[model samples]
Target chain A: MKVKVGMMSFAHLHADSYAHCLLNNPRAEFVGIADHDLRRAQQKAEQHGVQAFDSYESLLASDVQAVIICSENVKHAPLAQMAAAAGKHILCEKPLMTRLEDGQAMLTAARGAGVQLFTAFPCRFSPAFQQLRAMVQAGEIGELLAMRGTNRGVNPGGWFNDPELAGGGAMMDHTVHVADLMRLLTGQEIVEVYAETNNLMYHGNFDDVAMLTLTFEQGIFATLDSSWSRPRTFPTWGDVTLTVYGTRGVIEMDMFAQYLRHYDDRAGRIRQVFWGDNIDALMIDEFLRAVAGEPATTLATGEDGYKAAAVAIAGYESIRRGEPVKV
Target chain B: MPYFSGNGLSDTCPRRAGNLSSVVNLLTEDAMVKVGIVGLGTMGRQHAEAYRQMPDVQLSVVYDRHMDRAEAFAQEFGATVAHDLSEFLKGCEIVDICTPTYRHTEYALAAIQAGKAVVCEKPLARTLQECEQIVEAVHRHNALLMPAHVLRFFPEYRTAHQLVKAGALGTVAAVRMRRGGDFPRTKSDWYADFEKSGGIIMDLIIHDLDWVRWTLGEVERVYAKSLTFRHLEHLDYTLVTLRLRSGTIAHIEGTWCDPGGFRVSFEICGDAGMLEYDSQQMVALRVARRAEAGQAGGVEVPESPAVENPYYRELRHFIDCYRAGQSPEITVEDGMEAVRLTLAAIESARTGKVVKF
Candidate 1:
């Protein structure tokens, strides 16, 4: 039986891409798109040739086996709770909620409803990361001492800049991806975090640059450079690179490395022509497999989302106190 | 080409002045300024060669404590050998102090006292107190002192700074600079002594800290971690994070690892755009689109015009400023600021705490 997937909201930027993934996936059926903003819902539904629903509740109550919650960050907990109560599985965008309590509540509700909740961490699906993980598991590098990672991208403005709508700026939007990756690679919880966050780019009320240093309980240390430092004219978004420095050797991987350099006077600069495997498609495939009751290893649980979210919030506290804070 | 006396060094500066005699039309020998070089090390030899290329600056004398080395260097450059520091300072109107880091204060102070313009190699001195002393002496003697922060003269870095000032990349969000080289195997092995050379953070990454402050703004705090190869014998690595007063954050990586020959790269990320430069690249400045819409789009690789060696550019700037009675691009205060940040980095690395400005 094919998994019936309905999108909860069109508020997040990735909703359109997720809609395409659902429609294209062989094992999943695109049920419909729903949003409180009716025009957004209708526009996205029309673009994807799917049905449009006026409210998230109406769509959840329909014959949907799973829902992808791509609502504004502040709306995540409420929508996920309702979806859980309706007995539908969830695949939510990163930084699941602004508050730890809210993320915990969402996870609790999902657990009580006997439904799976997958957090969106597509970096786990990158082939480069897969290779790196295999090497680490095989002790290609001896005892892992430190890992350095960066998820720098161009700033996505509008709701992303608004603290109320997006939860935070670069620190929130960019941190969780690498945070989840670090947890996955080390298999150790981040016990302490120290961060330096600032608004050097826009000088607006939100942070555009952040550097987070995480110390794990297993004595592994890592630094995450999570900033919206890429320019709009940058070839692609920024990159997701990880450097695993172990006692024996070092392994460095750049996730977006498979690209040709293209230069034209029209653009007047060199741009990366990406022809790599679609990581997002792979991630969605894994999520659907898990939702369809197949044992999938790459699925990021709601608890995974909670841990990463909680670490980011603690990073903010560390920034405020001007020191490292316990997670 | 007439030298434009501002940031437009791109237009008039020759990309390749390696064959300096072929490019320059010399002024009358008597009308030229005479310069003295105070050491005969790698940096000292480069300064001597760069000075020899200048039509209006005469490479007058070369000096080193090791007589044979000084004699060899002077013979190659056709400069007279000064047996002592006082002899070197006597006939020279300008002195380039390229001695070991610890010896900078002694030679610079002597040159200033002799009423000569002074060009000191970077880190200014081993400590902040020494830099302040040099600054005070320059003020008291009314002398010109230009610290050789050569990155300010590098064509790629200068272009990045111009773009930043022109609002081409919007406001800078963060900066990451990397500079590394094989261990400095000097005559005395002074570079290996942390007390003398101030290790890699002081002697090497000082250039980056100065450049970052020039590009971003004043640094407000610093945190650092380092790895020393067997108590910093021949290799050392440092990673420093600097928070600037303008809210810009910078990651500066410096190493004295033996493998990589010598490499430098920087990426300045702003609100609207980003300017990237890697020394390994043929075209240095890769200016990206404004930050908006989807992710950053097409990039523009500005033609990295060949230019005079940065060392030559810096020396020329000093000589031109001295002749015109104008201040240089990098002032004593700027050198002091770079020093302050480096010292803080060292302190932070030792204490494992963020050193606030």
Candidate 2:
């Protein structure tokens, strides 16, 4: 029996990738797409050769067993709560929700409905990160000491630049992936956060640059450069790189480094054509396996998303107070 | 080349022998500027080589507490050895203080008081207070003082600065500068001691700190993390984040722990375009040698050739400023500001707080 999955909205850019994952997964049935903008829903549905529902309520009332939430940062909570009330599991895009209260409400609603609430953190499925975790766990780099990471990207200047829809700027958009990865690597909670955020690039009210200093509960510290600093002419979208310093040695991981440099005269710019494993497909497969009553240990849960979002939330507070704030 | 024009020499040169016309005649007749070097260490040898290449500069005296090292250096450079600081200051028209951080204030103050032009190495001094003393001495004595922040003379860095100033990358948002190498092994091993050398932040990353301040504006705040408090033997690493007054964010990483060869790189990201340079990728030449039997493999050395050496350019600029009776491009105040920013970073790392300027 294939698990039926519907997508909630196409506000986030990741919705297209997730839709393709569901269509390609053999154990899953791509049901339909529903968005407030019916034309967008129909357009995407026509592209995928699937049904288009006029309202999210109609999609919820369908026979789909699970739904993927890919709405804006602020809409994750309401959409997921509605899905849980209708007895459907959820795979929400990160960050799980914009505010802590919304995250808590989502977790409570999922628990009350007895449905799985998984956060989509595709980086956990990266082969490079998996090897790094294995080496560190196997005592190849000794005790963990510190780390430095970067999750920089070119500015996505749509709803992402709107402070209301995006919750914040680069700090909200980028910090969670690496924050979740840091937790997964150290197996510790972040205790404190100090951040410096500015909007020098665009001079918009929303910040385009954010530098965060995170201190873990286990006495380890790290810095994250979560900035929309890459220009439009960059070879690729951006990068996720982490350098782990330990007592005995160091391990560096560039997650999306498996690529061929394509210098095309036609395009008039260099480009990186990625040939790495499709991490989104891997993450979707894990979610389907869990729906099929199998264990998914590597999956990021609602709590993991909540903790990572808490780090970013504290980062904003630190910026306001001009000091480090405890998480 | 006509090295010294002797125009406006009477106002700045305290040891002028005669009236303006006679001084001009004397300078044009014999344009050799006698230069002295103190502390026969790495920098002293480097400055000696640069001076040897200049036609109008004569290396007159060399001094060090270790007389044997000074004697060897003077013999190789065909210069005389000064027995004491007084003799060294009297023998030269220009004094280059190449001593370690702890001795910078002493040598620079004495050179300034003796009314000789001074070229002091980076960091200015070990502490901000010591830097202030040198600044005050230069002002009080009306002496010529130039801090050797040689990154300004490096072609790559200069190109980057010019591009940013010219708005090649429009409204830069963020920058990352990295510099690191294995722990330096010196004769006294002072670099290993945090108190004496101020570790990597003061001794090494000050180069980037000064460059960023020069390119951008004043830093409004600083936050940092370092392994200096860990007390790891012979190893230090630091990461500093600076929020510039113009709102550009700069991240600087300095290390004395990388065993792989030295590396320097920078990335500037702006709205219109991006600029990136990595030393590891820009190598013009590389040489690798096979290991002999019963011997470890020889280390590979990568070289990137430039039109002119940055150190030579820096010294040449200093000499021009001295001859014109004008201040250098990198003034004593600029050196003090770099020291202040570095010290603030160190304080932030030690206290785990954001330090404001």
Judged by TM-score, which candidate is best? 2
Docking class of 1: acceptable
lDDT of each: 0.83, 0.88
Q: Which stretches of candidate 1 lie over 4 Å from their true place?
A: A38-63, A135-148, A186-189, A198-204, A213-223, A243-252, A260-273, B1-32, B56-58, B65-68, B80-93, B181-190, B228-235, B255-261, B283-307, B324-326
Q: Per-residue lDDT tens digits of candidate 1, residues A186-252?
A: 8899998878998877788898899887878975667788998887678877899887766556676
Weakest 10 consecutive residues of candidate 2 chain B by summed lDDT = B1-10
Which candidate's DockQ is highest? 2
For every model in order, the TM-score on chain A comes to: 0.97, 0.99
Q: What tens-digit string does per-residue lDDT give for candidate 1 at B1-357?
A: 134336546343345556667444555666688999997887897788778767677888988899999888888988899977788889689999998889999999999999999999997988899999999999999889999998787777888887888888777778888786556676688888989988889988898999888877888989876654236346566778888888778888776652434567888887777778777565445555666776421211122444556777788888888887888888998988898998999987777688997
lDDT of model number 1: 0.83
Residues A1-327, model 2: lDDT tens digits: 999999999999999999999999999999999998899999999999899999999999999999999999999999999999999999999999889999999999999999999999999999999999999999987788788899999898899999899999999999999999999999999999999888988889898999999988977888999999888888899999998877777787989999999998999999999999999999999999998889988999999999999898999999899999999
Q: Which candidate's lDDT is highest?
A: 2
